[model samples]
Target: MLKQKAGTRSPDLTVVEMRRALAQRIKLLAEKPGEHPTAIPGLSLYHRTTPTPCFRASYEPGLSIFVQGRKRILLGGTEYLCDDSSFLLSSIDVPAQSQILEASEKTPLLSIFLRLDLPTVREVLSRDDIPESPPSTHRQGLVAGETTVGLIGAVMRMLELLDTPEDIPFLGALAHREILYRILRTPQAERLRAIATSGDLGQRTARAISWLRENYAKPLHMEDLASTARMGVSTLHHQFRALTAMSPLQYQKQLRLQTARQRMLMDGLDATTAAYEVGYESVSQFSREYSRFFGLPPIRDVKALKNSNTALVSVA
Candidate 1:
């Protein structure tokens, strides 16, 4: 697990005010205690009345800010605990397990997900006034950082625009850019920089990830993936694992399982059919892997997931 930053400043009065405003805005915008789409594009609000189960889901490239409760996100064997004082950012698509750890009927877990825009990030990076590139670090795609007053204020502004639909067209994009700028100024900036740079090792590894996502049903070939990434096999493996916290093969397995699970749960595909559809050759192997990943047999797991009271809605 990543250690929390030492000597980090506690929330000041401004930050406290921002957090309170964010919580109130989310509560107002969220019609009920569930996820809801926001007026601004790429923004989603989640309101939970109680603690949640450890839900295994794929986290896309985005930012999640907690304003009222806490969440524990498990990536690989590492667990990141984030609450009202911090924020979580995922610069690339990753399979992660997350659960709302602190909430109640009185003060539910109120959070917001802001889908990061790569194009806007690149636009911000292109400016000559942008800060000099920091030394490269082999950080994982998922990160937790202290939430600054600026970031929360920007989010509050975006939420404030919800009541004025006409202003969203004019001000939403600017607010989004400001949010990105605030993120770029944080320690999370280096990871975002790696993704934004065109020829960096991180970006090349991202290409391989993209290919796997689009062609997960196809057999994985290391040489082909390396060739696609324009890197040597050894470098590809090293950088891919460093950026994603999993080897290429392991990453592909996650994609396969997640895709298969979604197929079974949402599309009502049977275990055998979903397995083959997701490129699993052996039914037994698929079942074993599925059981390990999802904690139950395919049929049973889907039944439990559907029957669960937890509601997650992603506008992205």
Candidate 2:
């Protein structure tokens, strides 16, 4: 049997070896930009040679693990930091920024992100000795836990598939499955596991979230959304906030404003048109909400995005 770790007993026998191998994998993947789709899709990984000061921005739901550095995330006015021994898990969609606290010119900030997918989590979770974590109120935008060796090992194997295209369609799936499985068995795997199997208020809230993203610009009705989530309107309202740290309407508003901002920046759409396209009945309302969420009016924000060159760029 694999020796149990000091604080946590990870079931995988090769946890330590796996972490060392994963260190190498992160180094290799960091060699080039866009080299890690097998691990994280839709993110443009950046290498930082300098330690960054505190900052905050919206963090999408995902796993962010650094191989050579440490960082901190600021959310709801709280700061959380993690190093090589730790990994960050963002369960729900959040708008927060993170700062790199540790980096070196020689080592830089080496990291890899695996964008979490709900459907994928569901599939892998159905297969193992996974246990349900007791539900909690007031979900966190982010949490940190000691990185398990098995999790690291699974990540390394997933990256290895990049060198061989033939292994992807078949072996790649298993690698992906194993990665999730390892996460299920980790110390704080409960948060992610909750994401996969909870049929409670949180899960219902997540379903309502899917509706918001899929139809951001549509006219939103609480009753309709509740029905879609298979919950009553009052229950939906309470549960959505309990899970996402924001109200349902607020959630929809964020989705609309972000997409509208993107349209203006990328497609060069005029502010009025962008507002209408993203489902604002009145341009005035769009401008008001856009400024509230993004800290700038549509035209100025678009200009800023263009000037920055890195502003609101798409994963593509």
Top candidate (lDDT):
1
**What ranges in model 2 sit over 4 Å off?**
1-21, 33-61, 75-80, 98-105, 117-120, 131-138, 313-316
lDDT of 2 by residue, 1-316 (tens): 1111124334454655665566666666566533344433433344556665443255666777655666776555456666655667777666555676787767666666767777888877776566655544325546666677667767677777778867777886677677677766665566677656768556677778878888988989999999999999998887776555578788788777877877877788898888899889899988887887667788886786677544352111
Which 10-residue window of candidate 2 scores lowest in summed lDDT? 1-10
Q: List the candidate 1 regions with Cα displacement exceeding 4 Å.
A: 4-7, 136-138, 310-316
Q: Residue pairs in steric clash, candidate 2? A: 56-97, 57-96, 57-97, 58-95, 58-96
* Cα-based lDDT for every prediction: 0.82, 0.67
The true-versus-predicted C-alpha distance at residue 273 of model 2, in Å, is: 1.2
Superposed by TM-score, candidate 1 places the C-alpha of residue 266 at a distance from the truth, in angstroms, of: 1.5
